[model samples]
Target: MKDPVLSHVRGTPNLLLGNYDLTALGYTVDEYFVAGTAVSYRPVGELGVDGHWDVVPAERADYLTRAVTVVPADGARFNGTVVVEWLNVSGGLDAPAVWLMAHRELLRAGYAYVGVSAQRVGIEGGAALVGDLSLKTLDPQRYAPLTHPGDAFAFDLFSQLGAVVRHRGDELLGDLRPERILAVGESQSAMFLTTYLNAVAPLAEIYDGYLVHSRFGPAAPLDGRSILDPDTVASLPCPRFRDDLRTPVLAVITETDLVGGVLPGYCTAGQPDEKFLRVWEIPGAAHADNYTIQGAFLDSGRAPIEDLAQAFRPTDTLMGRRLDRFLNFAPQHHYVLHAAIARLDDWVRTGRPAPAAARIALTDDESPTIATDSHGIARDGVRTPWVDTPLAATSGLNTESDRMSKLFGSGELFDTAHLHRRYPGGRTEYLTEFTTALDRTIAAGFLTSADRQEILELTAITAEWRFDPGAFHQSGSVR
Candidate 1:
């Protein structure tokens, strides 16, 4: 029961701190990695088949040292929540998706944050084929000592991190005394959490609540290599969850995740129960996009970086066909997630439950296509202002050939003449309706008042946005 050896890095950031600046968001950033030579874990019982109660089981295992990231909240504003993001090594680069999406809110609300480098690729370099995809390779001087035992030990490592933030293992968590330790994961990390919730939570209950965003399918591999490993097929499409749960799990899945990651029967799987679960199937959003990346730039007061997946155009070749509808998911997701984390805080503190959202209605056929209104926006689920405000009509569907579906989802804007035709009241009318909708949404508990001014300002900015004709269609046209 000895505490893991926790070390703070000072003077210079080894490969891990390579040009990744977080100061623009208002919080002073400090990076520390947790390491331990001996780690133990209780087994994550048998997998539950659909509708059958899973057999709760237990076993024991031991592993070596691993490093996890801890970012303390050191700023004027502290919201008293420590959001620990399971650092994503999916891109071979540490893609902090949820952090990027929710950082503005976390910083503004004064929440402490941490990134757990539980997987191999995060601490150890990707096995040869991926060349230098490790924090060590990125900065050997700083990251040289960092080590991760393997994927089998990741769940325990994450659990240890939760304890670190809650107990104030270091000054990185600040003096605010985090009231709730929230765990969230995006894309691949989400799947890992799904597994953790099912198998690990029963053994070690650490986090107050969980946000499984953009989770495409089932739980992570029990004893396999990390998905970021070059040889392993990391993703599995079977969407499953343990119905008999311990903590609240709020899952927000984008359109691209549905088509690409979650195949079929996820909705009807019967687990991920309503009592302990809240799943929001967003209509037109993608698995990944520039909104979060751009949000980082905006927060940092820096311009956009080189990743131009948003500007992707389909060519005659196989990679770029019928992808005209792909639009960078607007910033609505962050707002929604911000509100959700707030709800999570309330749910953990009080016994209050987070509001459940309507599931995105799927097609009758075997295929899982989202049904849409005449405006091409999703008809069901949480319809934020971006979906309600018809500047850009939406579709979550991606063509089968689109390998870039995770980074892009379907959004097609109306032509200039068509915009005027769709909204006769023009910008004035649009703003009024949007304000009304924002108010209603806030009342319904989907957004916070704190976000209104910023969203409204963004609306003003978008109103002046140069319409990209290449991605435009005539008004009343449905994709």
Candidate 2:
């Protein structure tokens, strides 16, 4: 595969969500048409239960997909690391899941970010997990030239994108050299990456590390079956990461992903950590959180402390549907994801692996169940102040209602009686314990120190809103 032709897009890039001000962050956003021919893969030997797949190239097809990039305006700020995200089309559009979740870390650390439209659903039309908002549907004239052969070519199309970021950096990344390239994906895209890592990565050899976020049990099939397919839906097998990994791959599993609601959970595929792979299962976190639907767009690292406080409060709605309970507003999931990006970068650069974490407690059953503590909070897994030195009782589990709400999880605020019983000294004592726990989590390398101040500020806001209601006006607004 030769270097693909890169053409600048004249109009705005439809990233679907998280339309934050890039210029304010000392970064520039650009969209480019990546034109090339991609090779689809076929299994050479047998595709086994253990995720080590043996595959060969079978077919080639021409593809012209869009890549949305966020890079430092000046080349001097470039940190030499580029994160190529597999844009998730589970929502029926090109959604930058990782970018929305961790853009603060990527921008603050000077890493360039590119989101690839590697799947056919994102370009052409298909059955949607959310709405039918494909690129062509969004704007037929602007995205008219863009073509995706099919999801059969997505694996290789994504591989070629990594190559473009690396070998052709001068053209794609504004002459900024990328020393390390990391691949990241969330949910459905993570499933595709699982297949790519097992079947395609050995032959392509593109990325330095991978952040596979919120994947369920089964990896996607090489035959290009959508998750909605009846035959594919009937038999979905849980597969672990291949033991013989050549690069560092960090799997970040959330509580909702552990014991899946609509789909099979990742618990069935749990395995021991290897030299090249580590899994971090976070408790009190849904596959999607308040941050996913709200905070990411509002938090620019430049917002007023009070503004951020207003942004992250608990809400009862997800994409649009009013859920039965308040969605999980715990910031641990977002903070931990940011830390994962930093840890993976350092792991690739210094050859030092990230600190190991305890998996979430689960009950032994034919269908596993997450075990919880006395307060209805999950017991163990990547411990944080929110769950450790608690305020509200939180869990990754929610009423199995709609698919989106189920993944959003649920939270219940502690009543005044429960608050007084837990913290006798009130605000002062609670803050002290919370701060200590936060420090310990940072030392353990689960939370980054760079985020400590913001976390502290947010904690103060939450505590005040709960205990000192007079701090805000009676209109129920942050003042």
Going through the candidates in the order shown, the clash numbers are: 6, 0
lDDT of 2 by residue, 1-479 (tens): 66689999876788853656788778888999999998889888777769889998999999999898889998898888999999998888888999889888999999999999989889987866677899899888888999989898999989989998989887778879999999999999999999989889999999999999999887887777797564785575678899999999999999889888757889878898999999999988889878887788878888788877776677786666777788888889989999999999999999999888899999878878888898888888899999998888777788856676677888888888888899999999899999999999999999999999999999998888877757634426521
Name the runs in model 1 displaced over 4 angstroms. 11-26, 37-45, 50-76, 127-132, 171-176, 226-239, 261-273, 300-326, 400-405, 466-479
lDDT of 1 by residue, 147-168 (tens): 6666766777778778877785
Residue 53's lDDT in candidate 2:
92
Pairs in steric clash, model 1: 14-142, 15-138, 15-139, 72-172, 78-110, 79-110
lDDT of each: 0.62, 0.87
**Lowest lDDT block of 10, candidate 2:** 470-479
* TM-score for each candidate, following the candidate numbering: 0.82, 0.97
Error of 1 at 178 (Å): 2.9
Worst lDDT run of 10 residues, candidate 1, spans: 308-317
